[model samples]
Target: MIPVVQHQWKGNLAQAREIQVFLAQKVILKPFKIKPETVLAVDVSYSRFEKCGYGVAGLFKVAFDNRRHKFHIVSEQYYTNSDTVPFPYIPGYLSFREIPILLPILSQISERPDLLLVDGAGIAHPRHLGLAAHLGVIFDLPAIGCAKSRLIGDFLMPGLESGAYEYLRTNGKRIGVVLRTKPACRPLFISPGHRCTITDAWRLIFTFCDQYRLPEPLRRVDLMSKRMRKQIEKK
Candidate 1:
């Protein structure tokens, strides 16, 4: 079981790095050599019009032998944020507001996923570590950040299909990868959150992708979060 430790603050972003280091130290890090049977995609969605937001997280169990990959999604957890908005959408300090509600639901899932795909930049941040790395360090789960757009990194256009990937560097470290998931689709920025190697991150991203730039698990989760949030507000 992954224990979650979220540091609350009085609207301060200064202590983010310290708290991240503490969380990274709290968990026992491991290097899993591929062979992971299951992968989960996590994402949060919000409507600025409604001034509301929600997160959707789930386990997408993938079975592989020597031929093809099969996926089965199970136990998706969805929830809302603390009604009162704490801060504006700051680039590097997103987890502060979102994870507070998301983590609680994530903890209740039965089986901890072998890999996590986050719908945001991972180590491709100004600090060389984004929220994906933060969650991976905190939970000790292998994770990859799959951002729809570039947060911060240098890369060549990896083209519009699988197998094309470029390295993303930040803080003098090759911290992220930009991969093309579909033909003629926008490429995704991928980075190691923590524990997982950069290679494994790319494999997981392609494993879950099915005709979309974003993986299926996270795409479903994002849709779920948006729909659920709208339903809650309507209620």
Candidate 2:
């Protein structure tokens, strides 16, 4: 996949914040018109002591058997570059720290995914541009953010049953949802990144989730990234 917009990844904090504000305007919230047959999930694991990061991108084919959806891995790619992380760990500027490594892995995947599931925030962010929104705008693809924790929002606890969810709002405007993917498990913060609406984001994530707090595709890539980081540490 190629980027629709180009911008420098390395910059000071002020410049980074400016870029987020500028790009956030380009995020398009609409229905994803296609029935996605394939999805690509991307995640990064940092070795802070080594000042390096490992990124993994996995492409999974969506399958339907017995009226239930399943995701099967089609291909997986890892970033093996030795480039030292250029940016420090900051709460709001995650795209700067991880996107450089992830883009290369994304480019390596031969088949373009119908949807992108990111393991981070989207418009739920304070600047309205998080890692998922940034990537979706760059690729011009429909993407969703499935974050493990809330960044900025006020939400009541969802019901204990699976698939239960509550709206996550900021200043009286809904930005995302606090979703319960599994019974009695911690909820996930989900939002539209770009080219999709809030309802679409939560619905898709709920469908992909099975017996786990995270959706299957995202869980796979998260494990892949952590394994890659462990391998590097052993070396």
Candidate 3:
């Protein structure tokens, strides 16, 4: 799918920061009421030696099974793209490096995703524009950020039970939630990227998770991107 909002991806650090600031303003945080029937999750794996990025976009048809009373993936499709990354690795500006490869993979998927799940930060970043938020605004879709680690927030550890979560806040304002999707596992940092409220982000992710810390869509895409990188490394 083509981005509704278009902008150049290559730039210097200063220019990238400026673009993030501009795009961050466009991110809308509100309650997404419609239950997502389809979700597109994306992840990028970088080869340090080759300076290449392998991006994978997984489209999953989701539904809540009445008997199970939980969300499940009904069908899935995977698309991949790889290219030498032009931008160097930077702590806050990951979208600049990853989005170029990811956009192509997104375009390959014919289904329109009801939601976009990203393995990175959202409004939780210092600039309030992380990879998920950037892509969310570009595609004009509801999106959520589910990062494995905290980027810029402090929170008390949530209980060691599934579905337990704590408010992740910065500057006394709630930015996201640190949630434990499984018992005895490290929690994930979840935030609304665009067109969704924090509660919506939390509920969707929690419902989508099945026996894993990462949501099903993200877990599948993460493994796919890693496999793509491994295949290139073997060649």
Best by lDDT: 3
Model 1 weakest lDDT span, ten residues long? 77-86
User: How does candidate 1 fare on TM-score?
Assistant: 0.84
Angstrom error of the Cα, residue 181, model 1: value is 0.4
Clashing pairs for model 2 are none
Superposition-based RMSD of candidate 2 using all C-alpha atoms, in angstroms: 1.9
| Number of colliding residue pairs in each model | 1, 0, 1
TM-score of every candidate relative to the true structure? 0.84, 0.93, 0.96
Instruction: Using TM-score, give the best candidate's number.
Output: 3
- Taking the tens digit of each residue's C-alpha lDDT, what string does model 1 give over 43-119? 76666663555766766666653455634454444433424444567887776656665666676676877887788
Off by over 4 Å in 3: 48-50
lDDT of 3 at 93: 90
The true-versus-predicted C-alpha distance at residue 107 of model 2, in Å, is 2.3
Estimate, for each residue in 1-235, the C-alpha lDDT of model 3 and write its tens digit: 8889997655889989999999999999988989899999999998967488999989899998767556999999899899999787789998988998888888777677999999999889999998999999999999999999999998999999999999999988999999999998999999999999999998899998889889999999999999888888898
Over 1-235, each residue of candidate 2 has an lDDT whose tens digit, in order, gives 7788998745789999999999999999999877787888888888857498888887777764436754444445443433567788799999998888887777766676789999999899999999999999999889999999999999999999998999999998999999999999999999999999999999888888888889989998889888888887898
What CA RMSD would you report for each candidate?
3.0, 1.9, 1.2
